[model samples]
Target: MLQGDSSAEGTQPPDIEWVFCESIVDAFPLLEEEDVAGIWMSRTSLPQTSEIRGMMQSGLMLRDMPEGVALLDADLRVIWANHRLLQWAGRPSGTPLGMTFYELLHNPEIMGPDFCPFHTALATGDESSSTLHSMDNQYFQVHAAPVRSAESPRNLIVTVGEITDEILQQQKLAAIHQAGRELADLRPNEIFMMEVDDRIDLLKDNIQHYLSDLLNFEVIEIRVLEQTTGDLIPLLSVGIDEEASDRRLSAHPRENGITGYVAASGVSYVCHDVQNDPLFIPGVADARSSLTVPLVLHDQVLGTINVESPDVAAFSDSDLQFLEIFARDIAFALNTLELLVAQKANTAQQSCDAIHSAVALPVDAILNDAVHVMEGYIGHSPEVMDRLRRILQNSRDIKRTI
Candidate 1:
């Protein structure tokens, strides 16, 4: 939409002609591109100033727009702003009209250092855009377009769109995709063996360390449900001291704690303020925030992933969402390991059973048949017969012992 005062010449397409009266700029929307000629003919019928003001008051309100739009003058002072911009600046309507952009926004980080898009656009008469985040963690992508007015050579119109959720979601997806690719690249047999021998050490050196590094958590622990007792057992842990890690590895986390609660309920939990949160069960003495996400597969909770930080409110809901997604892949890995272990055990048992059956065959009967068949060849020799008899008796005794 047209927003500033400018001469009609060269402003828009020839079909959409503009007429200026009393040096005031006005823009009207066309119903159809082909009907522009008709609108020009009826320009005289356009409402007067007072009626146009009434129409603007009644219908042209910019309060409902989600984007923040601001019109700046040549001096970089705010000339006009939509309701959204006013709300963002924490100012009343028309209150920020004469304030400079830097003066209006108290956070210097918003404009950044060494470069300002609005000033650059105003100076060079070029459009520019940048992505920035506020102190409150709200993200915005600002687009500054140079608007030339008949009265001023340098004017700018800056539009800001909040993209916090979108950016966070994209980041989460990227991390999960990377993790999935890593998991897929690994051989199943290798993962199973890793689970079988020193799973904690292997996980710390590979998986858990990556997660802790990415999320910047003070502690990361993966707790799995024991097959026989259904208790959550800490199988892999990283980021804690040697003593603390030893204790965590030696014992399972209590079922009544936050980690246990998530495992029991099969849901993710986030506690930003652990000191004030009743659900917070301190894993580290200095931890002030914690997040627990259940690792589940096929409606069954296999375990939980618990992360903690020393800073209060260090983790947000977005963190929990990301962890939950990663936890799904983890659950699949754990399930695969369990299945592999079961398959290996079954194979070993079958082998043992085969050996036992082979041992149970009638060895004594086969040896006796061999001796009886040889008796005809050795008859009439008592010396050989007595020696053979003694040998047979020893064989019988061996068979009896077996």
Candidate 2:
């Protein structure tokens, strides 16, 4: 170690120096729109999106708002919204007059049509999103109720968001301030966040037990959806209990129930009670409640997210939506990890489209070729070959294309 001045002799090493400064995620403390809208909601501290300058010049109006409301109208126009809604909408400086809400999103073409809440209200008379997106990289929580007026029965009284960048930034500041405590909680929980890479690696550096303890659950399992089976096979599990630690679960593609169902089906579920619920798996359904959320990247389910609780009916629709948001975060990291791993192998992901007709090669030959191509796959010993042959036979038996 380099000798420091005598005054610095007792200072800790840089590795242990600790990051006291705020990071972006921590820079903004996060709040959900739903939180401040409860029965006991405050009557003040609400700012309409239109009131915020630069966001509503295009004849856009923020109206029909409650003290703490946030909402938009059809055509994705910014009608009346809150500061918190502003954050969820990701509107910079409250003035996004010229820009459409969908314009801020990466896949507006698809998410936009679904964001047609006005149409939903007209149809159902009441509507709320189990999930939503304000922009390409951001998510939001939304609530809408029919606002009946003599003029228009289909009018809506929508209270939008309880989250904003300012709130997030404040949260970030608070998190930075609480770094010392957060560091303590980081133990035991192996937190891994997916960034712009493909290779999967553990977020081993920040395992402070204190953070893990505060996380409510001891373990979090992240499994990738195998394209072949549509199963949420283990890519990683953090703070696993004695029962499931260091173990890999078999992935079910297309056919695997629950885990497979969610991954392949892209459905989000909130298990208010796992042990008592019919959908809960038999043995592992010990938790009071659990959430099975889909991890999607580029509109494809890359994996499933599992969060548990000891209280029955523990998971809520809001919680499930939050898990989905987290899943997207995980998906981003996972995609990066996959890209990194694929890059190391210098090979493209094998698409099984041509199994039957490619080059007139017999299915058996194709099986051998695939077995060879898969990086971690073992040799074509009699047992393994027998398995591959059986799979091919099974497919042929059902007339299923590989």
Candidate 3:
């Protein structure tokens, strides 16, 4: 209802009209009309209007939030969902009202630390949280809290946020670490029985498998630096041109391709555009991007690992980081292999020295005894003397060989 007086100049005022609504929510539609100036509820309904207004204020805040927000009734049905929630569900504003919370999300699987979050919130009247994996391979973090009133808990307020990228990245990191561990997983007996070439081949196969399967890298090249010659020796190459694999390279920043620069400077390099990057040399045919990281261990650059792709700007900073980490593992594995070879060679040399030491004195004593016997039998027994002379020559030969 509205009331206004006529002006003292005798101008008549516009006619007043009264409108009635059953509740504040019903009155909201009328407020949008041009003719409706404002809302007027009876004095007895003021408290209810105030409560509804408070709820509306909260809803307005939730509507524009980046995270999905919803108000669920005691039965877990969605009483109201904000704009973000509706957008995520691909639904209109009022469509989700009577649907269950999970139904709105296409019945996502609850990945738990708290599987029954809504139930837990309702029962305990506290906040509960969980993870959800949707049918489309999307991940979400969900938190539910009870909305309480004077009489009892009437609804649950739920918030959901997308975590698909975060979860996938974490899983990939874990897999990379696992693959790294498997790269050098050789028993002592296996190391001892296998030849150097065989061991290197095994390591190469493991690296290729993990790079192609886990990292989704098809083109790769690994080179080991010869410390004495500064030569970059190819340890493994895959999906690379034969000429590039066999190309002679040295650890000179300006001489060889990106591999040499990374080996010499011990810095990772990302070539966003192969044609534009001066340091990049063709590896995979028609390659447009490349990533190279020095295989570093304990501050020393052992070698370099390079990967290429056909797509432009295919790799990112995160790719560089993951490759750097995996390169460290490769360096450690190569170092361990070298150490095993050195240890085996050292053991063999030590064994040979021990045998020579043990046989040296016995051979010398036998030679001296044979010479003395020969001198005594010189005239008496020419046959025995000749046999002793032959024995002396053979003993000397044995000592020399030992």
As for lDDT, the candidate ahead, 2 or 3, is 3
After TM-score superposition, the amount by which residue 364's alpha carbon in candidate 3 deviates from its true location, in angstroms, is 2.0
Candidate 3 Cα misplacement greater than 4 A, ranges: 1-66, 82-97, 148-152, 377-390
Ranking by lDDT: 3, 1, 2
Give the per-residue lDDT digits (tens) of candidate 1, residues 283-359: 67788888889888999888888888888888877677777777887777666556666877887799877765665
Q: Candidate 1 — which residues are off by over 4 angstroms?
A: 1-165, 184-186, 189-195, 198-204, 241-255, 352-402
Which tens-of-lDDT digit does each residue in 1-402 have in candidate 2?
111213333464554332221222221122233332211111231232223243444224443233235344444454555554454445544655533434433333323334665567768877644235434434344456666544346455555443445444444445433543333332212322233231133432232232244234454666676687543567555544645433434344333435655765678767675655565553243456677778788898787767666677766654554455545655665565555555534432343444335533565566556456443445546666667666656645544544
The predictions' CA RMSDs to the true structure, in order, are 12.5, 29.6, 6.2
lDDT of 3 by residue, 265-382 (tens): 9998899999998888787778999999999888988999999999999998778877877888889899989988888889889998998999999999999899888878877977
Candidate 1 residue pairs in clash (backbone atoms < 3 Å)? none
Top model by lDDT, which number?
3
lDDT of each: 0.67, 0.49, 0.85
The estimated TM-scores of all candidates read: 0.54, 0.35, 0.81
Pairs clashing within candidate 3? none
Candidate 1 TM-score versus the reference = 0.54
Worst 10 residues of 1 by lDDT: 20-29
lDDT score for candidate 2 against the true structure = 0.49
Top candidate when judged by TM-score against the true structure: 3
